[model samples]
Target: MEEEKYIGYIKYEGNLVEDGLMDARKQAQALLGFDSALRHFIGKRAPDFRNLDFEIPVRIRKGSWEALIPETVGGWVQGGLGIVATAYFTKAAQKMAEKDFSDFGITDLFKHAISAIQWFVRIGKHMGDTAIRSFENVQFLEGNTLVAIPNDSGEYLYVPKKMLDLYTSCNPKILEKIAENIEEGRELTIGTIVNGKVEEVAIYAEEKGIFCEEEAEPEEDVLFPELVHGDDVVLEGEVTRENKTSNSMGFKYEEHILTAYPESGSVVRYKPLLFLKCRLYGTVSRLDEKGSIAARRPKLYVSHLEPLESDREEDDLFR
Candidate 1:
């Protein structure tokens, strides 16, 4: 039997997934163009890594976002005449091409190099390594590429213009059916939109706000470590005494009160605090109103954290 290969799309709140995919596409475009320009300069000749300005690590300011010079150079390389890397070439062509060196006599060396660069960039961007910010996914279908964008908190799949024809074949119901199956007898993943909007019921259950009795089974117990505080702490934690508050979900929560904090840290819970359901090391961000400490949560990820000791212990004892 021929297995049907399906391309899925997820639409999330703030359109993060889509935004991420778009950012990747934009970066890919810029990088591909720059690579083309470089190849044009080194066409029919072996690529000289010494002479090629692949990308320079040019740090701007004391602590600003550090992007490769190729990013800037690529921007320059794009010109008015549909010239992809013209902007970069006009500004620093002489300087970039100053040192001449050559190696690897590959045919269509420039084209091949550009293609390779694009592949790496695409993979890196989709894997969330680049600066282009959109929460979306990309897939190739029927000789056309599709970028799925989010609408509301619900997951919506999208495809490139070339993919519209396959819409009938790509039924959205298939996704819902698959999701239903995944959620059976299982806690929901955070940030997974069903029909749009955050899965509040699932989130609350995961947070231990509901569906937990005094003598709930150990497996049902929601145990998360208290967040670690401090900028270097990496995991965003707030030393809030347990307090009462209403979350975005409109339900009053008895969660530990979190105050002004900076950075996203490790997630104490198995599910994410945000709409997206995934365990990742994140820093807590301080939510303030009128410059006053309001609440903390909705953190960003700096890096993954070590698994909680409890997790290790469980693994050892169980498995």
Candidate 2:
């Protein structure tokens, strides 16, 4: 973390950038997506590294109209990777590596950022529920449901978890926000400086459609579509109880424990993930006749289950 060197840079060309100008709104949004992408890249390794700040100094090519983040965006702050920013990021990176995140640092986050974006590009299309076999550094049974990520050096322990959060930046919702300035003639270059050179990922306007969301039907229970959702029907929680014979587990989201009946994939892969945070995707049970008269915790007919980052240790609540 050197004050003289940039950890990463976002370069924009064409349209406004060609004229030595940038739209303030688009700049902010691009930064938001950029910041979000970086956060996701480091989330699994540093789940609680929330308050982070970096000095984004605006730089312009001397003759060409290529614009890095604009000075107006930084706004009167003589911007550069100042001493304060460097020390802060360095100390934080060291702390994370010492505790839960072994061999991970702020620079490694930029490196993974490139990897995540490239992996998304490699998949070509969203796999959705179609089971995916191992594809390089990643393997998944369903969207966000990773099966394994093992490497020779044991480097990929957190990759799948990284991908889970990386989805936040790649989804159509975030794409549109980041691509607001993108048009037929415009181009975006997102890169991370590794060593002395830059590893760039080009984002073309035409290629933006490739990141578009696929069409799919909404999920609803066949028997009970209108049943009141128990506890506002949140599908995320810790596994408080499990019934191995029946392949059912109790999903605890605070005080309420909802009965969760997971599908086959979940049955096979979910037991080891108990006590960790999980997001179960499926339909909540409808309020039946007997339960209609009284309140009860709803049941989750789980179609898929994906574990969150491994940080929280099993404790009294999980037991």
Among the numbered candidates, top TM-score falls to 2
What C-alpha lDDT values do all the predictions have?
0.29, 0.51
What lDDT, from 0 to 1, does candidate 1 have?
Answer: 0.29
- The ten-residue window of minimal lDDT in model 1 covers 243-252
Superposition error at 45 for model 2 (Å)? 2.6
Question: How good is model 2 by TM-score?
Answer: 0.40
Model 1 superposed RMSD (Cα):
20.8
Q: What does candidate 2's lDDT look like per residue over 136-163, in tens digits? A: 5555545765644543233343335546
lDDT (tens digit, per residue) of candidate 1 on 1-319? 9632211111111222223232444334434433343344343233233343443222221121111222233233223223424443343345545532223222223323333332322322222122223344445455665555442234454444322332222222212211221211222221212233332212112222221111222322222223323233333232211111211121112332222212232222222222221122435433345553333333232344233333233322211
